[model samples]
Target: MSNFNIFLKQGTCSYCNNSIVIQRKHSGENLCPECFQKNIEKNIYKTISKYEMLKSKDRIIVALSGGKDSISLLYNLNIIQNRTHNSKPIIALIIDEGIKEYREKSIKKAKEFCNKYNIEYKIISFKDKIGKTLDEIINMKRETPDYKYACNYCATIRRRLLNDGAKELGGNILAMGHNLTDFAETYLMNILYKRLDIIANQYFFKEENDEINQFYIKKISPLIRIPEEEIFLYANIKKLDYYPSHCPYREKDPIIRKRVLDFIQECKKYSPEIEFNLLNGFLELSKTLYYHRKKKNHSLCQKCGYPCGNGKICSYCSYLLEFS
Candidate 1:
């Protein structure tokens, strides 16, 4: 034998010794690539059942941004809803944040997915509703000292639109594509920002009352136990044609949300259970906040007739006035 061995070790799947890229344990099949996709869908169905997010009469409106998470949510919800014999069907609500590059691409993907699934879809634009798109508002505010960040504008507008749009479409609840990692990151961000009310409202699911229910739509996320990476993988394996670009504003954000995400990523290095622990943190913190803050009675927003606090104007209205 030669002193130096020149043979390269050919790698195979650890589970079955079949040549493959991924080696993780899965639910069925030889599970090279296509098989893993099926496993994710099955897992999503189980998660939905375990959480009881859906019901016989729920009209679920999926918030589809054409991103990996939203596409995965739409796909899985479409499958599970049909099997449950749910009376109310699921629809997709796509909100365009007015970024030409981001919104345009995402809208195409959203329309495509909806077409393939034969699901009802609607698109709401900032320009049509607010009289100005992000590009217009940014240009107007470019010379001003009070230039708001992209996420600040995008989040405020989208939240209001989805709630309003879902209600308009006769939806009983709004389903979002938020996963465990997203929830954990958001939870930490709220703590850093001292947004107690947000944390209180962001518990796993919220019950809709006549006051807030009329103004804001009830929301649920069945994928909270799934990780972000898994969502991406699931979407790809399902051959979901999702908008593959990130919002330009994300990198531009100098906010703590990004840092919080990084912190979660670092913690995940040692233990994959960090996300589940953080989710537990959210559950614990939400109960604490709910107990501390007295529930406020809501009235209709004079402008839109949605549920509002004692104030006649809602956050969406306040956001609109910010531009003026």
Candidate 2:
């Protein structure tokens, strides 16, 4: 027996009798590269099905960022779409937050992937919509009192632009590439700050209403069950031409979200399934909160007609006013 085999007596894949290439710590399953990748795709399909995230006639808009998670998602979804009977081609929506060199590099990779696959794509920018680049926004607001982190501004602007852009492309469903780690981190952050309303807003199975649908595209994260590291591995294994760098603001910002993510990572060392636990907790809590919130009528923004809590203006419109 080889040294590797000797080290792991059960060195064969759990799904098949092939040499194991990766062992999933969460499930304690050893799998070969082929099987591992297959498992990831299978998980994605199952997540969509379990959540009822897609309908046959729904126009799909994939939010492609050219990063590992988003690229892997687009590749898998493309394959699935191709296999579906008489399904519409998925459109890729790329949002350029105008972070200078950072966003340009990713946009290049995003365009290349879309062109190579012959997928239709639309690119929107903060400059065109918000009237300023993120760099410019930060520079203008950094010294102001009550100035939020760059991530705060970027996320608000990007979310509005992505939703509007997707709707403009006539898409009813917006597919996101957020992985398990992202979900866990966000949920933890919300929990820390007692943001139950945000958690409630993310409930997976909300009945479709025309009023809400008109303003907000139905967003789905098919990769919600997959881990971040696994997505990175899958992207590399598939040899995807992805931009491997993160946004500069994400690393530089001393945001609580970053600390929460670090805490999650630290907990993962002792508890491999920590993220899964957090996700499950979120699922149950969000479901309960969703039904609870359903009793009250949602307050729509006076300007945009989107939900804005008790306020007359939504955060998106509020940010626009600030920029204006």
Candidate 3:
């Protein structure tokens, strides 16, 4: 046996006798390249179907960051949409955060992928919509009291822009690329901060009243069950053309997101199934909180008239006002 095959013999795939490419510690499944790819895609399909995240006629706006996760999501969604009769065309929405070298290169790759696949795409920029790029926002907010980290601004603005962009394109559902790692990290962060309202607001099965259904396009993350590294492996094994870089600010900022992610990784070393546990806990906690807080009325943002949770001004509007 060759050296590679010898390595494979140590842990052959659970599904087939092929060389093992991935060892899923969380589930204790050793998967080869082909089986691993299929498993990831199958999980994505299952996630969407279980959540009722999409409909045959629903227009999907894929939030393409040009990263591995988003690229994998867009590719899979395109394949699924193509096979479904009467499904609306999947549109790739690229948000340019204007992060100098980082976003520009990613946008280029995004455009290339869209062109190659003939997927219709739209590009929105922070400069055009918010009158300032993310870099500018960070610099401006540096000295202000209670100033949040770069990620705080970036995530809030990017979310609002993606929602509005999808709505503008006549989309009913917006698909995102947040993987299991992201979801688990965010859940832990919220728990650490005692942010029950945020958890309640994110209830997956919250009743969609007419008011909410009118203003908010339902958001779905099909890859929420898949880990981040698996997505990276899938992208590479599939020979996908995606930007292989992280945002510079992500590492530089002293943000809770990074710390929480690190903590989760550290915990995973000791307990392989920790992330899965966190995800399950988040689901139950969010559902319970949603029922308890269902009757609570959310105030509209004074400036934009959008649901602003407990605050009079929404975070989106607040950021815009501060930066403007």
Clashing pairs in 2: none
Model 2: per-residue Cα lDDT over 263-302, one tens digit each: 9988988999999999999999999999987877788888
Alpha carbon lDDT at 125, candidate 3? 95
- Clash count for each candidate, listed in order shown: 2, 0, 0
Each model's TM-score, in the order given? 0.85, 0.95, 0.95
Candidate 1 structure quality by residue, lDDT tens digits, 270-301: 77688888888888888777656636555777
Model 2 residue 292 lDDT score: 89
Q: Which stretches of candidate 3 lie over 4 Å from their true place?
A: 1-9
* Residue 301, candidate 2: C-alpha displacement in angstroms: 2.0
What's the true lDDT of residue 213 in model 1? 55
Q: Model 1: which ten-residue window has the lowest total lDDT?
A: 1-10
RMSD of 3: 3.2
Query: Where does model 1 exceed 4 Å of error?
Result: 1-35, 205-208, 294-313
What CA root-mean-square deviation does each model show from the true structure? 6.1, 3.7, 3.2
Query: Which lDDT tens digits does candidate 3 get at residues 138-172?
Result: 88888889789888999999989999999999999
